[model samples]
Target: MPRNPATTTRDALLAAAREEFAEHGIAGARVDRIAARAGVNKERIYGHFGNKEKLFDAVIKDALDEFAAVNTVLEDDPVAYVGEAFDRYREHPDLLRLLMWEALHHRSAALPDQSWRAERCGRKVRSLAARLGEEPSPDVGRAVLSLLGLAMMPLAMPQLAELLGAKMDTPESVAAMREHVMGFARAALEGRASASG
Candidate 1:
């Protein structure tokens, strides 16, 4: 069945809100600018989402929901899952950077409860636990968390490498880092070394 135009309008507002929040933190994102970017009036945004803060929360949650929909974490192999997750982040750099920026600035707390995050994290945990063929372990969560951090943190915070006295942006540097991180992540998650002699 055909969808209502209101749904499209809401999606547009959410997309515009994401751009505004990602470009400028929540404190700087404005309803007028978001409305102009969406090609809708500010009143529509307010009427639909209530206010700027609520809209920002909705935008972030919507992005997260879309990402969760991809469900790449279903891979049974931890290394393959890490590689695929890295690819997803590589393809959608904005989402990773936006998340990083939010975390670094502690803006997530300003939005609403973190039950959403806990839920998302819980899903990953369940998927990983099944893959490992045993009960969920803290190591599983840590492995996934560390893998994502390794793959995304540098891109999310480009200055992180410079701060650590390394150039992490170049192709060679990036490739090397990816290899190291993936290898370490595989070993860490599987709790074993490669079988090569």
Candidate 2:
């Protein structure tokens, strides 16, 4: 029999899966545990998501979508958007960490049928191009990549960032770092802008 669609159980499962995959990575995550956390039967996970990899993919896509919704608001000013992007990432530290964990562990499981990652990059490229009144230069791509990298790499390598004297993970430190990096990024994006302006 088909389960009723009115319950919040699906939402619960996705949330639990996000936390689990964020912590455990693909190989470490277990459907039974996700189901248990969601208060659903283990079989229900299979019934709903079809498999573990799909569940993780859904979680990642959802996270990316949520991040984009917040960070991509100032389309006319991507340099300013970078600050907001940093703020969004700071508020949702786990999402970046989860992506990092997946990368570090080399979990190559296919992330569903969606490639929101590439789509997001493309959107950034277009946004950067629009801000510059022309196609974005190679530097723009590099800057956007660096902006994301700077935002994420610190958290991904806390000890290393700390070793380099860039303390991350603290609320205040992260905010300061975001401001500093955004300033640098804005300068790079608008290199010829009058300093007085």
The Cα local distance difference test for each model comes to: 0.72, 0.73
Q: List model 2 lDDT by residue over 51-84, tens digit each.
A: 8877877787788778878635434765567777
In candidate 1, which residue pairs get closer than 3 Å at backbone N, Cα or C atoms, i.e. clash? none
TM-score, predicted candidate 2 vs. hidden true structure? 0.80
Model 1 vs truth, CA RMSD? 4.0
Worst 10 residues of 2 by lDDT: 188-197
lDDT of 1 by residue, 78-159 (tens): 6656656666676777677567556655543434648768877877877877876645678667755786776666566667
Residue 65 miss distance in model 1 (angstroms)? 2.1
Span of 10 residues, lowest total lDDT, candidate 1? 188-197
lDDT of 2 at 18: 90
